[model samples]
Target: MSHEYYRRGKNWFTAIGLLFCVMGGIVLIQQLLIWGIDFVEDFLFNAEFTNEKVSVAMLCFGIFMIALGFRKHEEKR
Candidate 1:
């Protein structure tokens, strides 16, 4: 029962992470198309957090969550 609950939790994490990744990717792509290469340069170097930066952060966080969800648990000796 506990294992099943853990599995369900992991599933939720993966699902949410996937959603975040998709949304972030879409927004990032849209920004790229609308703003051009200069935007990319700004995203790389600028200190201020912009919408594009938020999208990139979302993308990174989503990937991290996904990885965490899929990580294997070690058996206690």
Candidate 2:
């Protein structure tokens, strides 16, 4: 079989790993109330997460996890 076909199992594992990555990255988003980063109230109501710091943090975390997901997929290749 081709390398692509041979790598199917690895790709499955990578996808599973990516799920964990996304979960971990969004932990902050989940823990918003405890950390005072709740987006709904802070963003829409109080303009809380609308600030640069929170936005940047969220962006960095999201991008990092997404990059990690790609890296995980690549390793299987």
Candidate 3:
């Protein structure tokens, strides 16, 4: 039972975490744009538009994934 195998697996988790974080960040920016546009139209033209709560959820999940990626997985001797 070599520790190297566990270390390799840990690296994979870090990569996946980073990927999730980046994707979530992109989605968050898109949501902000949509919300900003909606707000402007509603203010200037009296139209109703709202930002979806899912964006915030995605952001939170992404941050959580990023934190997980940095966690160390050391095999107990």
lDDT of 2 by residue, 1-77 (tens): 76554343444434655565566456545556455655445553563445434544655565655565455334332
lDDT of 3 at 40: 39
Candidate 2 global TM-score? 0.32
Residue 65 error, candidate 3, Å? 1.7
**Best candidate per TM-score, number?**
1
lDDT by residue (tens digit), candidate 3, 1-77:
76486544446555666676677667657655767756534543443333334444555676777677777677778
Model 1: per-residue lDDT, tens digit, 35-73? 887877687578877788888889998999899778876
Residue 23 lDDT in candidate 3: 71
- Backbone clashes in candidate 3 total 0
Tell me the deviation in Å of residue 36 in model 2. 24
TM-score for all models, in order of appearance: 0.73, 0.32, 0.47
- Compared with the true structure, model 1 gives a TM-score of 0.73
